[model samples]
Target: MEPHLPTTIQISAPQHAANNPYRVIEGEEVLSVAFREFVLTAVAAGWKEPEVALTLADIADDYVMALARRAAAN
Candidate 1:
């Protein structure tokens, strides 16, 4: 595969982000950039696409389950 720069995803709701005290707008942007860099680095270092996808899904699943557990507790 030809080498290309990883793209950063732009946050669409900067105003809403600013209104939310729990999440900083700049922090989200930085995390996105960092995530892209990590993915690019992983691919460059011989990680397969499936592995990367599975990792992402696992992370998302963990987050979702944590939320679910919190809701149940509440």
Candidate 2:
């Protein structure tokens, strides 16, 4: 059987208001490059597609938190 490789992934980048934390914009392609790079690295390391998906979902919250921290620092 052939391997089930993924052809696409969605990455979003939000625009946040500096004055108000509640004001935000969405639907931006901000992290497409980073996301694709990470996925390619994982695949090259022999991570199957399903495992990659499940692991990504599992660490999503932690990843978002890390991103938030990075944003706060900038």
Candidate 3:
């Protein structure tokens, strides 16, 4: 697999953060998939910007650790 860059999620407004105006650019397939899942879950749960940000960051960190393990197995 190619080296994957981190996904980019821009939250323009924190106070009135909705699912519509967010800018998401997933640089890698797996990262993109994980990111989408997190965002969807957050949206469904009606989470605000801070909570969503925390969850996304946690997901990204977990993803990187998983990737590292996979790489080490090769």
Q: Using lDDT, give the best candidate's number.
A: 1
The sequence of per-residue lDDT tens digits that candidate 3 reaches over residues 2-71 is 4444445543333323463432332344456656776766655567867888877898799999999999
Off by over 4 Å in 3: 1-45
By TM-score, the best candidate is 1
Model 2, residue 65: what's the lDDT?
93
What is the C-alpha lDDT profile of model 1 across 6-72, one tens digit per residue? 6554434454455677568566776687677777777776798779868987998999999999999
User: Which candidate order results from sorting by TM-score in descending order?
Assistant: 1, 2, 3
- How do all the candidates rank in terms of lDDT, highest first? 1, 2, 3
RMSD of 3: 15.3
RMSD of each: 7.4, 7.6, 15.3
